[model samples]
Target: MEQTYIKKILKTRVYEVAKKTPLDYATNLSRRFNNHIWIKREDLQPVFSFKLRGAYNKMANLSEDILAKGVIAASAGNHAQGVALSAAKLKIPATIVMPKTTPEIKVAAVQSWGAEVVLHGTTYDDASKYAQQLVEQQGLSYIHPYDDEDVIAGQGTIGMEILHEHSGKLDAIFVPVGGGGLIAGVATYIKYLRPEVKVIGVEPDDAGCLHAALKAQERVILDQVGIFADGVAVRQVGKLPFEIARTHVDEVLLVNTDEICAAIKDIFEETRTITEPAGALALAGLKQFIARENCNGCHLITIASGANMNFDRLGYVTERTEIGEKREALMAVTIPERLGSFRQFCHAVGQHFITEFNYRYADDEKAYLFVGVRLNDGLEKDRLIAKLRDKEYPVIDMTDNEMAKSHIRHMVGGHTQSLANERLYRFEFPERPGALLHFLTRMGQRWNISLFHYRNHGAAYGRILVGIQVPDEQLNELQNFLENLGYPYWGEANNPAYQLFLN
Candidate 1:
């Protein structure tokens, strides 16, 4: 069965539009990691992603009569562009159903490729359902983003190219997983051709569909997926890809948004090319794997999958990269509200660069300061925290705290003692025009919104920190409301970071 796929991969006619991207050695990354780091520059493709290979190959394999009927696909961005460009090149009409929450840049890109861009739903899964409906209604050929044999074979061509370019002993090859298409294809080829080369799949921790599926020994639908790495923010692993992945892929590594951001910085430093969060995922996973296994001097390969990033998203990436690389420390420190106290606190912090400092006069006795200080490494955070604690400053380490990182850092003022029965909850909803209003409307007038904070990270989903004044008697009602709201949320009422800074 594997041999048949190998043959199919060999015969994939992706070269009609897809370029054979280079396997460039990452010199700076290699030196830093003490390993031979090679990057498969798939981002250099015409569509700025590897999806074109699979999309074109899948469409190219279709009969001319079927092509005349046109094709339809549902994708957030990269895959949509792939299908659109492929259809344009083949002179086949294509209709791409994208989520309404998709970034405008991606929508414009798909439209530019001459595909009919239908904005629907709030997520790729939703768009997929709509696209499927069109496929049935119009008798259009549906080109799956992944899961198809021809598509997987087309992606497998990347593995073939990798092996051809670097036939040397490679310890591992890391591929970012979304629907498990890229990893499945690459892993199937690599494991068959070179069994010794560990084929690892990397996924965002918030969207660990592949990881969950692997653990469950079957494809499992995630309740919610993080849209930070939108290219790979799939709620469920593809059926066929998951099947292939389970058999061949060595491990699935979950990396956080910060780690992915850091990886993007790493790629930028080495190649001077900025990659999207999903594009840098494999590198982030490779770094984590190296640290966990303490392996060095080994040849490691990671695919830089795509560069179709919105220019605005860089702000969020830049903000998180330092913390991700252990080069920044965030803390909430309480000092006496006195002129001399500030001087002493700065003394304790020492010569470190202050990245952020937010303070408000709380009371006569004590004031809370939310601060970000630069650090050299992980040990520096411990030392800095220890120094602050030793100085008798009430210090709360906000490092690794999601609540602190996402909302509390920006919202440091207006802690209300008058607002009784206030419950804080962090919410994630599809980012669209009426999303927040829809949320507020569904919340109803029964509960008063005491506090609300929203920050756009240029992702498909919008994150909001909300404080609602709910009486103890209405706890069940609040639960019911949240359940019916159908949005991912977590009660941050008890979060220490919220208590330390925002409260």
Candidate 2:
């Protein structure tokens, strides 16, 4: 039962496994971060994760008669594949009960490995109950994802390999934590062998079960869980793993969804290998800790635990990375409706990329702008509004304003196709005096407004939705001159949603 001896068994299990996974040295990260860095590439393992090590050990430890009876497991995704593949290798029957909401790809993978896949429940708790019932009814072994000793010992093999391949001393090892089995095993083994080696655990900030449980000095259940990192989105840490991690883990770092996405992009750029959100978490944690603690020139290793990514989810990943880098931030800015107010709005900041600019006019209130700003290094976020304030313009920070970003930004781009040709859009904008009259003077009487919708929403600049009926041939010429005026505009008529619903 002593964990120190578990490493010996893990070594035996390592020989049993057929995968000689590479402990890839990260050349790019080492040079960029100025640290000796390497990746423990368990993401490239045969089962595409370290889960198989635990799953296989648990199965092999069973008695001959118990093995004949088969095994059952309930997992959201990764562990199901682990057990399915492990049992199939042992020539024993395996039945995997997964949440119905589990991604189609993981389901197909489990079935391909010859496991009977039963889609049940919307959450892991429900699927687990179903698996327990099956264990009782069929007298089959209930193989846990990480709650058993044998499983822990098997997963410890990774720590052994890490030390074997990464020579000399290690300043710290960052690992992604879910239910704590991986950390429990790796931390326990590492601390026993190298007491000074820091074993830091990373958990999704939205679902910090292990971190919470370890802090409480007992396993605790979370009332809610986040599914962004589906593989690590557990509500509670297992009791057995909790015990090991509580005493061994040096620290627990919590990272958000955006940070995890950025880390995923970073690793993909480095190795050209895609990792699930959960897998990228260790590296996210490392960057987070280094920044917080101001660490430099330390030997660091991050375990990339799995690679079971939902391919379709890449679009969401791409979207979040824009926001994560602060290269693109969403916020609402109010500018008065007037002649020069529009020009003043552009002059507030020295230079920044405009990702999106949407405006709508209502009730002569201020013209509202939903703006996205591109981020660059050394450009602190707080400085933007200060520069605008110097110009006597007001900007509202909505970087964390999820509702305005997700829902409003999409609707604001809708086309003006609903307006009749005779309708005129006049810029009654600019809250400052002499602004609207100046705008009219600059237009040189060439424009006629058929429809006018302008609002000075108590802001410096006002926006108006203008519709003009000109010769169809004049479209390109008028647009070219409008661009010279230095205001951003979108042609909503070309939006896909315009064609689908509005048309």
Clashes of each: 0, 34
- For model 2, how does the per-residue alpha-carbon lDDT over 1-503 read when each residue is reduced to its tens digit? 45544644555454465365677778888887777778888888777888988888888878989989999999977889889988888899999998765667788999999999998766678899999999999999999998888788878888877877876878999999988888988887788778899999999887999889878888888876666787888889988888778778988999887788888988898899999888999999988877777777888999999998877678667767766655677666667866676677877756887777876553253555667778774255667867776776656776655334333455564334444433222232323445446555666667575433454322123445445555567777667755664333334444332222122
Best by TM-score: 1
lDDT of 1 at 489: 90
Q: Which pairs clash (backbone N, Cα, C closer than 3 Å) in model 1?
A: none
Estimated TM-score per prediction? 0.97, 0.80
Tens digits of per-residue lDDT for model 1 on 222-312? 9888888988988899898988987899999999988999999999998888998999999999999999999889899999999988888
User: In candidate 1, what residue range of length 10 has the lowest lDDT sum?
Assistant: 410-419
Error of 1 at 11 (Å): 0.7
lDDT for every model? 0.90, 0.74
Once fitted onto the true fold, the runs of candidate 1 whose alpha carbons sit more than 4 angstroms away are none
Indicate the residue-level lDDT of 290 in model 2.
74
